[model samples]
Target: MVDADWKPSMGFIYGELRKATQEIKGALNDNENAYKPILDVIKEKSSKRLDTCLHMAAYILNPYYYYYDPLAKLDVEADDSIVEILGVLFPGDYELQNQIKMVELPMYKNKLEKFDRPIAIKACAVNNEKFDPANWWDSYGGSAPNLKRIAIRILSLTTSSSGCEIIWSIFEGVSNFKS
Candidate 1:
C-alpha cells in the first residue's frame, strides 16, 4: 500500500496508527488502560511524521478523494497549506506562485465543482473498478499542466522505506541459505 504508483492508496498510511490504536482499544474494552503507554507512544510518533505537506498534497491530488468522492471533505485550509509547501520548495519563484494562483487554483476549483456530477459519483460508487490516478492526470495534463506537475511530484513519493527493508531482509535470507 506504500507504493508510490498507487495514488489513492497512499493515504492509507496517514492516520494508520491512530486508527489501529482505536480499533484495538475498542476490541480490548476495559483493558485499554493496560496498553495506554504503548498507544501513547504510537500516537506521539504518528503525529510527529504522519501528515507532512507532501502527504496532504497527495491526498488533494488523489482522484478517489478529491475529484471522485463527493462525501470526502478536504481540509478547509488545504489551499493555504499547499501554497505554503510550494513556497518553501520553490522560494522566490514569482512565476511559479503566479501560475499557482492563476492556473492551478482555478483548475482545482473546477474539479471541485465537477465532484458531484454523475461521472465522479459513479467512479466513487464502483468498488471493483481499478482507477489509476496517474493515468487520469496523464490524459488531462495538458489542460492544467502546472497543477498536474505538482500532483505528479507529490503522488510519486513513497511515505516510508519499509518496503525496501522487507526486500533487503528477503535478500539476506536467501544469501544466508545459499552460504
Candidate 2:
C-alpha cells in the first residue's frame, strides 16, 4: 500500500524532469562537445552525490511524463531530470568538486544503469537506524542552505524528529555507491 504521505503527483516531478531533459538535450545539441563535462557531473550526481534526490524525484514524478506511442520505448526523461536538477542545484560544484580517484565499483564511475530508483530504494533499506543526515552532510561537505534543505526533506519524508536521523541514514546509504 502507498504510504499516507505518498501523494501520487508524479506529474509535477515529471514536468520538472522533462524540462531538465530538454535543457540537457539543448546543451548537447548546441556544442556537442563543450558540454560533455556537464554530463560527467550529472553522472556523478546521479550515482553517488545526489542519487537519493534524483531517485526520489523520479519515483515521484515520472508517472506523468506523457508521450506518443511511437517514441515511448526510449524514455529516460527521469534520468534527464536528475542531471538537470544537479546542474541547477549545484551550479559550479561539479567542476569544483574533487574526484575520489579510487576504484571498486565501475558502476559508480561510468555506469548509468545502476542509477535507477530500484537501486536507490534498496540502498536506503539496508541502512541502520544510527544513520544521521546532519552527520552525513557534514561528511559530504555541503553548504548551509543545501544541508538545510536536505535535512528538511529527509525529515519530512522519514517522518522522524526534525533532527538528523533520517537524512543521515539516506546520505550514508546513497554514498556507499558513487560513480
Candidate 3:
C-alpha cells in the first residue's frame, strides 16, 4: 500500500541515502590498497538492495520515473536491514518485496551526457509507446516551436558527441529493426 499523499523531498531523504553510501565508502576506505574482500562481502550481501534503493530514490525524487525493479524482492531477514532507515520515508510499506521477471532487457552502456531535462520530463514515458520525438514534444505551455527546436538542437549535439555513442548505437539498432 502506498501513501497517496506522500511527497518525497531530496533534502529529507538525502541523509539516509548518503548514510548508506557512506557506509559503503567507509568500508572501501578502510583499506585503500585492498578492498577486494570487503567489496566481495558487501556485494554478496547488499548489492541488490543498494540498487533497489537507488531505483527507489530516483522514483521518489521524480514521481514521473515510476519503475518496478525485480531485485527488490525481500527475503525473510531483509526488512531488518533497512527498517530503521527507510521506515521514516516509507512507513508501513514493504518496499523490498517484489517479483522477478524471468526475462530481462538487453544491457547497453550509457552515455555520459547530462540528459537531466529529458530524464525528468520523460520519466513517465519510460517503456511506453509514445516515446518518439513528435509525440513527446507535442505539448507547449506558451512556445512549442521554440522548445522543440531546443530539444532537437540538444539531441543533435548530444548524438554527435562521442560520449553518447551508446545512445546512438541503441537508436541505430532499434531504428534498423523497425525498418
Candidate 4:
C-alpha cells in the first residue's frame, strides 16, 4: 500500500514493475517451466491493475519521463485517459475544460511541439534523482492547476498491495508472539 503521508509517483512504480518483470524473465531463462506460471500471473495482474486512467495520467505528468525520457510517448489513448480521470476528479470545473481545450488538446495534437517551451527548459536543468515530483506539482499548481491536481492524486497511489501485506505479516508475528 502507499504510505498515508507520502508515496512514489506512478511513473516510478511502473518503471520498477517493468524492470522487475524483465529481470525475473532473464533469471528464469533455462528454468522457464518452474517460473513461467509466476511470470504469467505477474503479467496478467499487472496489465489489469496498472493499465488505468490514473496510472497513465501520473506517468504522463511526471517531468522526469515527460521531458527527459525518450520512452515516454504520449498518444491519444493516454490523453483520453487523462481527460477521463480529470473529469471524474473535477466534474464541476469549467476552467479545467477550457484548459484542456486551449492547452492540453493542442499539445496532444502537436506532439512534436509539446516540449518546446518553459517545461522543457526547466526540466533539463533539474536533477531528477534529488527532485521531489510531488513538491514540483505543488509549486506548479498556480501555473498548471488542473494538471497539478491530477498529478497529485494519481501519483500518490501505490501500484501494489505488498506494503499492506508486509504490515499484516508483522502484525501476525506480533500476535503469535503475544499468544
Candidate 5:
C-alpha cells in the first residue's frame, strides 16, 4: 500500500482478505474439534479488526469477485447493509437509488447492453488476467451510468492512505533539519 503502483484497489481488498482467511483455515488441523476452537478465535479477532461496510461495498461493486470468485459464492443478501451504502451516498435521492437497484444493477449483473458485447463478454473469460474490471464500467457500462460511477469510484480507490505517509516523512525530514 505504501507503493502507489502496487496498491490494490479498495474493491479487491475484502475478497482477497477472505481468500487469505480461507487458505489459513483450510491449511489448519484436519480434525474439526481441534481446528474449530482455533478457527472461532481467528474469526472473532479478524472480524473485530477487519470487517467494515467499505470492504463489503467494494466486494459487491467489483464484478470479478461479485460475479466470478472461484473460492466462495457471492451472497448478496449477506451484504445487504453494505449495498445500502449506495443509498447513503446520494442521501435522500430515492429515485436515483431506485433506478440503480431496480434497473442498472440488474443489467450489469446480467450482462446486458454494451456489457453483452463481444469485447465485454470476453473480459472475464479470455483476457481476465489482463483486463481491469474498473475500466469495464468506462468501456461497456453506458447503460448503467449510476452503477458505472459507483463501480469505478470503489474499484479505483487505493486500499490505504499511503500518500499521507510520504508527506509525514517529508515533514520529519524538515523537522530533523531544523533541529
Candidate 6:
C-alpha cells in the first residue's frame, strides 16, 4: 500500500487486507493443526493494523469497489466511516454533512444526473489498466462539489512516503560515490 509513485490509494489498504485474509485462510487450511496458532497471530496483527475508519472511507468512496464490488461489506460500519470523514472535512457543520449524506453522496452512489453520463460511467471502469480512483473523482465528480472535494483529497493521498525516502537514499548513495 505504500507505493510512492502516486499509484497507491487508501482503498488498496482494505483490498490488501482482504487478499491477505483469503490467502492466509486458504494456505492454512491444509495444515490447520500445525498452523492454527500462526494463523491466529497473523489475523490479530493484520486486524490491528488494517482496521480503521480511513480504510472504510476509502473503500466506500472508491467507485471501483463501491460501485462494482460484489463481495460482502468490510467489517467496519459504512455509516460510521462516512460520518467520521465528513466530520473531519466539515467539523461542526452538521447541515453540510446532512446535505452531503442526503443529496451529494447519493447522487454519486446511485450514478444519478451527470454521474450517469457515458464519459463518467466509463471513468469508473476498474478493469482499465490506467484506472486511477482519484482521477475518476476529479473527472466525473463535478456534479457533487462537496463530496467531490473530499473524495479527490482523500483518494489522492499516497499510501506511503517510503517511495520518496527510497529516492532520497538512492540520491545519497550517488552523491557519496561522487565524493
Which digits, one per residue and each the tens of the lDDT, describe model 1 over residues 48-141?
Answer: 4666665665565666566544433446554455787678767999798778767766765565443335565455333233665555555555
- By lDDT, who's the top model here? 6
Q: What TM-score does model 4 achieve against the real structure?
A: 0.58
| Backbone atom clashes (below 3 Å) for every candidate | 0, 5, 0, 0, 0, 0
Compose the digit string of candidate 4's lDDT tens values, residues 37-102. 887888787775765676666656666555555445644565567678757866888687768657
The per-model lDDT (C-alpha) reads 0.60, 0.38, 0.33, 0.60, 0.68, 0.75
TM-score to native of every candidate shown: 0.59, 0.27, 0.20, 0.58, 0.71, 0.73
| Residue ranges of candidate 5 with Cα displaced over 4 Å | 1-4, 29-31, 70-74, 125-131, 161-179
* TM-score head-to-head 1 vs 5, winner: 5
lDDT of 2 by residue, 93-139 (tens): 76422221122111222322332335332333322344332333233
Q: List the residue pairs that clash in candidate 6.
A: none
lDDT of 5 at 63: 66
Candidate 2 residue pairs that clash: 108-179, 109-179, 132-168, 133-167, 133-168
Q: Which stretches of candidate 2 lie over 4 Å from their true place?
A: 1-18, 48-63, 68-72, 76-179
Top candidate (TM-score): 6
